[model samples]
Target: MKSVTVKNLIDLFKLEVLIGNEHIGRVITRSRAHRPGLEFVGYFDFFPMERVQVLGKKEINYLHKLTEEERNHHIGNIVKYHPPCFVVAANQEGLKYLMKYCEQEGIPLLRTAEPTTEFINKLDMYLIQALAPEMAIHGVCVNVSGIGILLRGKSGIGKSETAHTLIHRGHRLVADDVVTLKKLGPNTLLGTHNESTREFLALRSIGLVNVVRLYGRKAFQEQSRIVLDIELTHWKDQALNNDLELEPKFSDYLDVRIPYIEIQLQPGRDVASLIEAAANNWYLKQQGYSAAEEFMKRLQNE
Candidate 1:
């Protein structure tokens, strides 16, 4: 279900616990929060119980105008729905009645000093990132010329060695051995190093090495947006029937298509330089310039 507990939010936001300390372990499945304004007016038909209920200044002011008996009745009904928790934003007053109701019902009541809008904005961002879909790929990711390039191939095909060479050339290594990919938006895929392998690269003869320590901090990046995927293959696998021109190919990750390319690994080929050139070519293509297309046009003119 990929749920985070109310305790996580409490710790992350440093929220003050007003009541129901024992119930902080309650699960919060939804990333969005709800304001209980309409629910306070005897309208509970469409209320969302899965979301955290927020009591802002506007809702608290309305509650202040209610009679003791009426306020308790409405608050009791709202608590009966059993929302994950209730957050009082801006630390508004007039929350004694609501706090008492939550305490009685064993519902966690949290108080934050931030305004309603700002608090919600931060909470939403945190929840979205915490709940984003993620996957791991067997490859090495590097940032070259501001472009994230992923190198994939069978083990022992020099993916790590290529990344090591690139790092020496001033490019930054994002991940090696395993790259974790998270889908943040519809078309955005972020790549990061797996925690166990962060800042470490494995080479066939050299064994494990710390890339950051060897090349300094500039040789490693915590994460990068994967814009291109390159698959390294044996030289014998190169197909003679394939087109030699720069044709755009795509690889799908979390339903987002990324530009894909394949490079043949052979003796004496400067794979690192080729990778750098690929990154530069990708940058040029993004700027609406294609050297291959321009060359074709020139040939036609000649």
Candidate 2:
């Protein structure tokens, strides 16, 4: 099963490890975090014990209000359920029973500098990516003129060449040669670089080029939500749509439908410029303006 370790969280977020050093290696199978508001009041119905537990000012203050016996009883209830860890957000200190009970029960306790909501949001984003279903495809993912575009084609095609042109034209490259895509939710697919070949892009003539070192940080982005997938096909194929308009095209990835298109590659056809135009047109359509639709309407009026 896909899982992330508690140690990974500590290293990823620079969390201060308080107790349960040996338990730091414990695995967290769930992607969401839980704030134990009801659990603190001795209600444990359907509580997700495997998720990371977060305690903030509201929860901490509530626990502090209870008497020693009442507090320990509630804390023991939470600890016995065996949560992955308890993170005290906003850099809180002096968590007496909460700290002691976790240590005694061998549950990992952690602290973070961010506020409750902020830390949870950041942590959840990472968790979703870490645990989400991921697959690597032989394609390039780029941010072309503010739109995320995935270029796909067979080997020796112009994918790399077109991506290099877009990057040289001040657009950002998310990943080259191979892009790892993660399904974030029902409608979101995030594209990112693989750890092995992150900062490099391949050019047939020059081999692998360090894009960031050569073009600086402005040439790369950590990730992008893929909005369009464009497949480059040979001109003579005639099997794909060449003049698709007046309606949208779509394809599925991990059961989620993404806008898809096909661009033909032939002599005298500037595939790079075509890609840029596609990206720009996609952005315009997103803003409720379709150049193709407007042209059709003009023809009807004429």
Candidate 3:
């Protein structure tokens, strides 16, 4: 449901607005662009009206080959469909008639200096980032050994405290209290700090601290790809007696399942070290080395 206006595109691309100043608010619901070559020849059966129509050199040349009446009729039908906007790439001239139609129909007409393919690629990338699905979660996200590790637990479970310690140990903190996660692709989730608390971290003893200033800019990251999830829980005597070796677990967020682990927080246990080790272990697992699996294989062979 995410959408961006033609004005947003203009601002992002710095395009020249040839017409339809009043209709720059047209919504662009799709990230893809259409050439409309067939539609230009008076075929509109499968025209994608929601996409931004991109008029390249070939389409413009084809329009020039037609007679005045033929050109207007075909172009008129295209405008009648109410496309989001028309972007004339390569800064191609001889678009006066098309601009006139856009002005008459109140459809925004934009011009870009870049070639058609390059402009389309840039616009698609921008739209994809702008329209990605996002959600905020109550947790701490940090870059541990180049792996984005998310710490989740109840209030006062030391999520922020562990993040603080990790930052001191040279790991970058992405978000402390609220982690905003965006799904960029089918299996990719990007994590970033909430704008309100981007460079700040909250702690019980010291009210609020600026991590960037305290630990330098290297101690913070604007965003990172989430790869692991670590949940903290209070220690129980019975739980400690369970199997020491466990299979890998996964947690789902935005339909992407991330490698997951649970650590027990106890009075004397070093939570920061445990989390750091967990991150390193996760990295090793990604590299195809699993200590637990190897040990299990050894037991089977014996």
**Candidate 3 residue lDDT tens string, 125-165:** 78877788999999999998798988999999999998999
**Model 2: lowest-lDDT 10 consecutive positions:** 238-247
CA lDDT of every candidate: 0.90, 0.89, 0.90
Residue 296's lDDT within candidate 1 is 83
Off by over 4 Å in 3: 37-46, 61-70, 241-245, 296-302
lDDT of 1 by residue, 43-151 (tens): 8889889998888899998889999999998899999888999999998876778888898888999999999999999988788767778899999999997899999
* TM-score of each model, paired residue for residue: 0.83, 0.92, 0.86
For candidate 2, give the lDDT.
0.89
Residue 14 of candidate 3: its Cα lDDT? 97
Give candidates' CA RMSD values in order.
3.1, 2.1, 2.7
Model 2 TM: 0.92
